[model samples]
Target: MSYDSAKAAFADWGVDTETALSKLAEIPISMHCWQGDDVVGFEAKTGNSGGGIQATGNHPGRARTPDELRADLEFSYSMIPGKHRLNLHACYLDTDQNPDRDEIEYSHFAPWVDWATDQGLGLDFNPTFFAHEKADDNLTLSHPDQGIREFWIEHGKRSRDIAAQMGAALGSPVVNNIWVPDGYKDTPVDRMEPRQRLENSLDTMMATKHDKAQMLDAVESKLFGIGVEACTVGSHEFYMGYATRKGTLLCLDMGHFHPTENVADKLSSVALSVDEILLHVSRPMRWDSDHVILLDDAILQMAQELVSAGLLDRTHIGLDFFDATISRTAAWVIGTRNMQKALLRALLAPWDRLKSAENNLDYTSRLVVTEEIKDLPYATVWAEFCDRMGVPSGQSLISDLHQYQAGVSGRG
Candidate 1:
């Protein structure tokens, strides 16, 4: 299964493997920083990861410092094909000062910006609404108290400013995403009040405008978290409407929906209202477990939708998973590579033929071709792309990952 043969086979279906690889190389997956540290940020006074967030397992080499995490990321990025961006949380600030969330300044994260610049990587950012004392009650932006709401709002505002600076430094637009864990564990008498408060806080936080080329605002929604079982203030309906009205990107986390719901389907529906989208690609495993993503049917369908619907350019694809059970760096390499593989698979799809069959209402042809194309030499094309990008695949990839893990095993 040489790449030439695979390319020829795809050519028979009117697909260009070279073009597919070219497109895939340009699309970057924003790898999350929390994965290396098990979501235990390096904040001066880091609080428990409440708000239904928990990363299980006690991997030996969990990154305990900013340098360690960056080292691990550098290694992980080395093994992954194509250039990618890094998604950072406010709590991951590499600073000597012990500033609280609301008091954080861009200076606190200047080191990260400098490092990213040196590595020729872009950056994305998030305001840490969880793992803070104010969010102990499972509420922050939508909290009943005005002071607490204002604090979170200020934090969000500062985060956007910092993200803008990062993007400006890197000459790329940084996605400043906001995901608050404001909900009630038990049923509440009045759900509208919290949502109203949340809307107000968001409006105030996003009042200041930055250059679109520098920063893009995004709001993420969740179905339900571990404790917020009864009601989640920032539900999908809430953020979708907010993003549509506010003219911001709506982040659709794959793990934020119900088990039966196909997140791939939402891309077309949401695209009608929202101009841009941010995807938090993760494996839920029945719940929002944040398991490292695999090249499964769900991910494949998502990649297909992004390509077939012509939404790739308007979408920001980011990884959102933290599994401490395995090598943290390995997790990043595996998940990021899987995402690229899925996109490559979709790119190689004979979409023109499939769409022609569907447009003509030829269900039999569509079904048969869809099923038959599954047997195409996708792996061969993927291996070629990896080789061109100077990264290993198959057994070589496994061996490289294990070697890195063994090297870093001495970390306390």
Candidate 2:
């Protein structure tokens, strides 16, 4: 869909509003980018911070304290020149260093609900879980948290309930981003057990949330690491394979593809609802090359095809970068700009011509090229158009321009 059409849809849905700065805080995006259904931000959990948690690896830095997290959000708002929004981790659930008891209050995330609401940003507070639960056909459940039966079970339930309550508190929909890191290491692994538990939990929550707000079960796929041997939504086929399953959808992470896989093809193969396609956008670089790279042409082509197929409006975009040495601001800035560049190009692309090419289908030698970057109008012009129409600036088009220009000069 065209950007204009998308904004019109937002306006029609009453999602476009001039929220007070105080209200902005309530929305996760106000503090970080990628809080929208179409996008959200994640603070990659890295070990370290003097907390001795050997579960993953020696952490580079400790998770930010609640106060520190709040301060950083405020700083992010101040320093990131344009109006930006984000989705924040109420707590890093996957981190081994984080206290099991403090799972719900990771970084005192609950308190921020009020603070974020006061800031005027709607919250997309996410709680997380690993595949700790295993089931047998006899319907037996087992968890590794030892006290899982007594503590974590209730903890997980309460977490979901509180999320619903937060939705009521903020009067907005909440998304529970689930990444089941339940896999084995050439050892015992029960994949069905975790899937059942997840589905059951989602069904329970969906029944309650049907009227007031929505819950998104964003299942992130994992590779063989940390004994996380199972892949939730292993491939787009896995997602489609389990349709009618209830209360969840597939979340595609860019890095999940095979080393030499074509992302566009993966996008095409997705069997879930078009609207259910949540995205975690980042480069899947190997070795010395920084994982952060421009969106390749194939991926853009795939996205364009999806857009033409009416799937673009349903997807949410987010950053899944893991840069420890770099400042979060720099990472977020680059990440956001890359997404915009990629999306805008996809939108303005001669999609009709590309579709025709698909029939003749030759991306080999003598490929037909589209307009030069110079020919495109500044994104700010589009933003200004949205502003005139009373739609709060969707993005800082000028910032996008500069970021793009930087890439042209090899500074990006």
TM-score of each: 0.99, 0.62
Worst 10 residues of 2 by lDDT: 48-57
Scored by lDDT, the top model is 1
lDDT of 1 by residue, 134-207 (tens): 88888999998999999999999999999999889889999999998888889999999999999999999999
Tell me how many residue pairs clash in candidate 2. Answer: 36
Count of backbone clashes, every candidate in sequence? 0, 36
lDDT of model number 2? 0.44
On a 0 to 100 scale, what is the lDDT of residue 4 in model 1? 91
The local distance difference test score of each candidate is 0.93, 0.44
Error of 1 at 172 (Å): 0.4
Give one digit per residue, the lDDT tens place, for model 2 in 27-73. Answer: 12223332111111223333221100012222222223444444445
Give me the runs in candidate 1 sitting further than 4 Å from their true place.
none
